[model samples]
Target: MNKPFSDKLRAVEPYTPGEQSKNNDIIKLNANENPYPPSPKVIEAIKGFEAEKLCLYPSSSAYALTEALAQYHGLDVNQVFVGNGSDEVIALSYLAFFNSDKPIFFPDITYSFYPVWCRLFNVPYETKSVDKNFIINPKDYYSANGGVILPNPNAPTGISEGRGFIEDILDHNRDVIVIIDEAYVDFGGYSAIELINKYDNLIVVQTFSKSRSLAGMRIGAAFGSAELISLLKAVKNCYNSYPIDSVAIAAGVASVEDDAYFKNTINKVIRTRERFSQELKGLGFTVFPSHSNFVFASKPDVNAKSLFEAAKKENIYIRYFDLPRIDNFLRITIGTDEQMDIFLNFIKRYLSSLSGC
Candidate 1:
């Protein structure tokens, strides 16, 4: 019998998101989501959203949210592009810019989605391995390639490089598009938004999910030169003219306008992350220095897979990559203080029991 699926579809492996549990009682920390609720203004905006607007198509350009983001980042309105989420934005970007014969480059241990997009788009790509310390050597990116895309405060590892590091990459690859995925920048990483005007080849993508507490809303935006933004919009319109809905636009605008709430929430996550890292260290786990909402760690004597399974039994969800080099480590999101304490206490008891065994 003949298969019906397309050859490309059959060959590609989709990206796997963190496990999501529907149980309300579970201390869910697998996904790097904000522990707090969205701003009160966002709540009111969603509540006050006109139900009648659902009958009408949202702005194809997502003008209001785009305008809010442009103003927030001090960029011209034409320099902004909004999408369903940062993932969509980055995926569309891959389609728009990574079509050259030369392969694009990203860190080997960075966000898993980079390779997925490359395959889906039929874009050739190469991975530059980060050193033993999980630090992406800026020099590795300085090579002949179609383009470069990497996360600031990279995923799983959560290690962030400074503006100087990013600038060095831009300085080398001025001919091709360079994307800085800043999904976790608000946590503690320095943003590349300010460098947009200075580097026309650069595009900085950010999401409202992690920091603005709008993951459910699915609002993401990209900042770049007007020329690059135009290309992204062209690709987006080809795929989905109205990627963001009316309700999301209103919520996103409110979330951006409430700067005070955004800052406060980020500070809370930072404090909790620092304390949790120290606590994990005290427990003899090697915790990677994180600038994002999650920490990557491993205890030398314990099997990470075993610990992950044990945590699942207790209704505590965390992330564990079975991929090589990272299988021994666990990626734990920084939840609220009370939740962290609960997890810490469970870990202490679990280790004590292991010692007895």
Candidate 2:
């Protein structure tokens, strides 16, 4: 039975996504999902889609969605590549650009998927440790390598690096590809899309999942030079040409077009995040300054794992990683004001009961 599996499959450790509970009663703040619903236009677009179109294959090129994103981001259509999800885009990126004898590099505490993709693609890679403060210094990534990939407003910690810092890394490693995963940029982080034109080595990946409230649609995209985009397209076609379906494409276009709704929802999440952060501090938790929709925090008195279990018992879900360097922190997504109030109240009671207050 073991002999039937591919060599790569045998060695691979799959990435674990945040827990998605089946209980509707649970306030899901584990995954950094947008608390609000998608734009009404996205719903209309999906509903208006012709059932007859399902009989035929979707456009392999995803032209309509690609063109819409290009227009939204002020890029040429050829510079944009659409995918089923940012995860797929990331996987394809590893296939397309990171194939080399030299090892690629990413922050040790960054997206867990980066190393997983490297293994799947047989791409050699190295991890650079982020500072004790959980900030990624651009200077650490100045070494030569196959390529580089890291999340901006990095996941779990939600720390964001500036454009100037990114430029410094690019300046040093001019010959290698630097992939910036901007999954949470719309919430509060600055996007690397602005630096794309100035640096040929830059590739910016973003998704509708977090900001546009379209995670169910599974729409994601990448922005790079035409040559790099073409390479990704080629790899994508080789794997699965019709990665994005008609329904998703239509909804994605509407999501991009409705900029006002996008802004309103993002602002709401940001406000909620800031409020949540302050409240956590008042409760004796050390909260990281998060530019993304989630906050990484720790309570000195209570164990994060214990609190995670305690929250789950009360129909609330938050992320707790048992991995080293971050085992103590809880990555809590910013839900609606009502939801956060419920969560905060629960934590307060839990801590009070512990101290017999």
Best of the candidates, lDDT: 1
Candidate 1 weakest ten by summed lDDT: 1-10
1-357 in candidate 2: lDDT tens per residue?
Answer: 356555645566999999988889899999989989999999899889998979999999999999999999899999999999999999999999997799999989988988888887889999999989998877788777999898998988998978788888889889999999999998778898988889998999999899999889899899999999999999998999999998999999998899999999999999999999999998889999999989999987789899999999998999999999999899999999999999999998999989999
Q: Please provide, for model 1 over 1-357, each residue's C-alpha lDDT reduced to its tens digit, 9 standing for 90 to 100.
A: 356755544467999999988788999889999999999999999899989879999999999988998888888999999999999999999988888999999989989999998888889999999989899988998889999998998998999999999999999999899999999999999899999989999999999999999999898889999999999999998889989999999999999999999999999999999999999999999999999999999998999999999999999999999998999999999999999999999899999999995
Misplaced by over 4 Å in model 2 are 1-9
Candidate 1, residue 154: how far the Cα is off, in Å: 0.4
For model 1, what is the alpha-carbon lDDT of residue 167? 99
User: Which residue pairs collide in model 1, if any?
Assistant: none
User: How many clashing residue pairs appear in each of the predictions shown?
Assistant: 0, 0
